[model samples]
Each structure stands twice: as C-alpha cells, then as structure tokens.
Target: MSPARLIGLLAALLVAVAGLGYLASLTLLAPAEIDVSQQQAYVAAPVPAEAAAPVAPAGEPVGVPVVDAGWLATNAEASGVPEPALRAYATAQLRVDKSCSLGWTTLAGIGWVESQHGTIGDRVLQADGHSSSRILGPALDGSGSFAAIPATPESTMWHGNDRWDHAVGPMQFIPTTWDIWGSDGDGDGVSDPNDLDDAAYAAARYLCADGHDLTTGQGWADAIFSYNHAQTYVDAVHSAATAYAERTSR
Candidate 1:
C-alpha cells in the first residue's frame, strides 16, 4: 500500500471510532436527564396518596381507651372523678372521633382544675353524674378580675343573676358555650351542663372542634390553649393531665 494512502486510511478509522464514542456518551446522558426530572417530580409530590378511611362511626370512637370499673372505682375516689363521668369522658373521646384521641386523664385534669371533680365547695356528684348543687362561677360582670361578657341570663335561678352570664358545671363552661355543644349523656333527653356526664361530653366536643390533631405535645398544648386563653392555664392543665396519665398508666 502507498504511504499517503495508509495515513489517510488511519485518519478515516480514527474519525469513525470518535463518532461511535460520541454517540455512546449521548445515550448515557439521556437517561440521566430523565432520572433527574423524575427526581424533581418526586420532590414536588413526596406524600403518599391515602384513602379516606373512617375514624369513628356514628358518634362512637374507633379506639376506645380502656377504663374498667375497677380502674374507675379506684381513681374516682382518689381523684374525685366520678365513675359515670369518667365513662362519659372515655365515651366522648371515642364518640367524637377527633383525629387525636382525648385522654381520660385530660378530662380528669380539667375536673381537677374546675371544681375538683364535683367535690368542691360542699358539692357532691350523684349516682347519675348530677351535682348536688349548681356549680356556678362568679358573675362575669366585666369587672377588674373577670371577663365582662354582654350575654344575658340563660336562667336566673340556675345562673344566679340578671346582669351577666356565668360558667356552669364542673368544667366551668359558660351557658352559651354549653348551649353550642351540650349533649344528653345519660340518654334521658335532657342536656344539662350541671350533670358531669353531659358536661364532660360537651367539653370533649368543644376541644375536638376545628379538626385539631391532639396527638403531639404541641397539638395538645394548642387544644388546651384554645379552651383557655391563659398560658398558665394551658400549662397547668397539661401538667395535671400528664401527672394523671403517668399515674394511671402504671
């Protein structure tokens, strides 16, 4: 073969090899670009798609916390939380079907705060969860100490005055607040806030409003804050509730 022809043939072979290498490089980069795009898509929508599962059915709870008669009897006397009222709290927890379950100890905590489980000021809880006497707060006459709500009297005899409204029952819910969430706990057709059963259920319903998730510590704090605006009140309720839960879980 001639020398020039040999050089030309070598050059032609080198070009073909370079062209093949470039084509391979493009092929390799194509999937990488696609993979990067797929990653970006994943970053945009990272959550899993889930079905709308039912939580509680017909005002009944899906996960009912176990508070047996034995447990109830022991805690009731010690904590002044009545058995019927405790049962009512647990039932409301399940019945309300909030995403976050309202612990019974939390109810006990509220009981401790408001009226000491209906044992405050010579008042006592009856067998059916009714207080021996009305548990009313000082008139919210918008004075130096209390909130001056412009609400009229729901019932003068029950609430004690005509000027302003006061809270009722062990939970310290004002009549207007109770009217929104009042329930018939004993199924006798009357929704009385003076009754612990009705009061407890109403309290739970009030707390569970706005789909507030009460599972995390923050969620619990937020719920309590909503119930009472004071930071001190929220802290006290959380502490009391935590203590009760720690005690009873053992």
Candidate 2:
C-alpha cells in the first residue's frame, strides 16, 4: 500500500474511535440538574403540638380532684357570696348549721353531676304552660324563669315532674319539688333554679334537712341518698363533689 493511503486509513480509524468514546461517555454520565425542591416537599413538615395532641370533647369530664373538708372551707371563703341576703343567711347558718360547708360542697357536686356545672342547655317552659322544652320558648308561669328543659326524655332520670311534664333548672330540681321545698338557698333574694348560687344553697338546705352530714361519712351518704334514693346517684354526687374539691384546691 502507499504511505499516504496508510496514514489516511489510520486517521479515519482514530476518528471513529474518538466518536465511539464520546458516545459511551454521554451514555454513562448523569445530568447534574436536580429538583431539590420536590425532594424537600416529600419530607413531611413538622406538626404543631396542638395538632399532634388528642382533643377532648366539650363539657366532658376531664380530671376531677378529691374534695375534702379543708378544701370546702377554703372554697366557701373564696366564693363571692357578697349579697346582703346571702351574707346574712351564711352567717346565720354558719352559727348553727354545722354542715353548711358540706351542704354547699355537696350541692356544688350535685350541680356538676346534674348539669356539668351548669354548662347544659337552658330550661324554658313550653307554650302549653304545663309542658317544658329545652329549645322551644314562651316560658310558663309568666315569671320569665329560665328553667332547664329536658334535652331528651331520658334526661328525666334526674328529676322529671310527670305532673308539670318538665325538668327544672340549674340544680335540675323538679318543679314540683321546687314548689314544695325550693327556697332562696343562697339567700340572694331569688328563688330561681337557674341561679347557680341559689341552687347550690337550696341543695345544701335540702340535704341538711334530710339528715345528711358532710362531716360524717354516714351523714354524707344519707344526705346524698336523700337527694336520690339510688346508690348510683349517691356515688356519682359524692365522686363529682370530691373531684371538684380536689381540682379547686389545686
């Protein structure tokens, strides 16, 4: 072969090898441009404490503390019973009413158990004057009294006056019972069951009159029994009162 022809063949072969090497490099190498934003998005964000924690329902029992005599006394002192009528009643009762504090405490407990500390729906009379409804209006007796209407027929477990056909107010006292025994428990110049203080005081009066003593186990039990003859009723009131006392003390 001629020398020029041999050199031309070698150049062609070298060019072909170079082109193959370039093609292999292109096939083996990866692109440098990456989408870091998508990767970051894939990594979930941190959740807030509120979002992470389980939430409790409204008016549901959380943690109820134990209520003792000392706690009751402290609560009585702290409770704002400033009305002259209320103060007078408290003073008079304190002189001879040994279980006044206990009565108040138990009443508070009963209120909590009965109405979840008055957070339940408002009580109002029905248009018929004999019946009562929780949501509907036109209060009977023309007293503009805010009574607790039965949320359901089952709510009658507390106090349902078959005669009046309605559940009563703050303390869940039946209208019939209110008629017979309801008085200004707090001496706040009001005998309405919607008034928390009055209802608490009234409950105390009823329990005390029924021979319950907060200072003694028997008395407490008896008083609770008087409120409702059921053992479950007594247990619930006692438990709730004890819990409330403990929580308030804290």
Candidate 3:
C-alpha cells in the first residue's frame, strides 16, 4: 500500500531469485562422479603352469583353447569388451607361447587402450572378427607428435599410404611391427592387421616374445613397454588390465 512497502517487497523478491540462481549454478557446475575402485598401482596376478596338452604341430592348424561361451559373455559384459574381441584375447592366451604366462586380461587391456576393442569412433567389431571400419593412426612423418617413418614398399600395402606409414587396425600396429607380428587368428588363412582376431593374436605373440613371463612384475611391465615404447602407455595398459582383472575376478 505504501512506496516503502512496495520497495521492500521488490528487494526481497530479488534476493530470493539470486539465491535460487546460485543453488542452480552449484548443481550444474558440480563435477561428475568418477569410479576409482581400481586406481592402485599395478600388480601381477598368479599364473598357473601349463596344464593342458602340447600345442598342435607347427604344420597343423593351431588348436584354439576351448573357452566356455558363458564365461566369455560374462567377462565381456563386465569389462565392456565385445564378445568377439574378448574371445580373441582369451584364445590368444593359450595359442601363444604357453611358457609366457600371458593373461587374457592383458590382451584386453591393450585392446581397450589401442582402440576400445576395435569399436572406437563409430566403429563396431563385427561378429566375424573384423572392425566395421578401418581404423588408422596419424601419419608417422616425424611431424609434431609422431615419429618420422618413411613408408616401405611393403608398408604401403597395409596402410595404403606411400609417403608415410600409419598404424593400422584395432591394435594400431605400424607397418614395420605388423610385418613381424601379423598372424592368422580366425583360420581365414590371411593375416590381416585390421581384423581384431588376427591383431589380438599378433599382439599376444609380440608381448610373449623374448621369453618374457607376464606373471612377474618386471616381465609384465617390460612386455607392455615393448609394445608401445612408452612408460606412460605401459602404465595405462597396466591400469586397464588391472581394472579388467579385478572386474572379472568377482
């Protein structure tokens, strides 16, 4: 009814609106929650000695380790790895040098880091063990963040680039490395780096090379470091592997 009364009411309404705005800002600006259950330093898991029969003769098709489908499905769901990619990693553990003690989780860890099990960037790992689309890394022309690697005659075929070599496939194998580690994992007779099955098998063999026993801390770290040639990469893979292992262990 009075000017002073009207002014007092307006001031109270403005203060109330400012308080609501501050509360809304706090709600909108709050950081998202992060899961940190497996954030500790990497630890090696116990690996059992070879208890299965000897691998098939060199000339014969290598026998894939018989894995339970349900087990693969369960672990895949837990670790966010596709069923086919998870199968490739699990089978690789036994198909590789049995003495190396490589765990499936380690392979899954590398797959997660390299390309999220070949499903990164709108790419899906098909049931036939191939990525829906070809995944290639930046050119290694010794530019800002990449090593200067000239394309070799053979390297051009895998990546289709004549000037500079790029890492190809889900595992991101460079031309040089793929030449040494490429393998046929799906019994298709062709060793293709773009195929998740073949890439995973190749990665396993590379990690198991040089008599590295992946069950030991030093051995595991060295194997991962050799794959990426970076301590940071090794650490990330280790952390991913550790998380996968912990998730599937339960």
Tell me, by TM-score, which candidate is best. 3
Clashes of 2: 7
Clashes of 3: 1
Task: Say which prediction, candidate 1 or candidate 2, comes out ahead on TM-score.
Answer: 1
After superposition on all CA atoms, what RMSD does each candidate show versus the true structure?
27.5, 35.9, 20.4
Identify the runs in model 1 with alpha carbons over 4 angstroms from their true place.
1-68, 74-80, 151-157
Report lDDT per candidate. Answer: 0.57, 0.40, 0.68
Best-first order by lDDT: 3, 1, 2
Candidate 2 lDDT over 23-130, as tens digits, reads 222222221221212100001112222211122344454221112333234444543222222222222233224533342334545654565444435433221111
Error of 3 at 137 (Å): 0.7
Please give the lDDT score at residue 224 for candidate 3: 84
For residues 42-108, could you state the per-residue lDDT of candidate 3 as single tens digits? 2111222422233333556654454555666766897677999988887676577656767777787
> Of models 1 and 3, which has the larger lDDT?
3
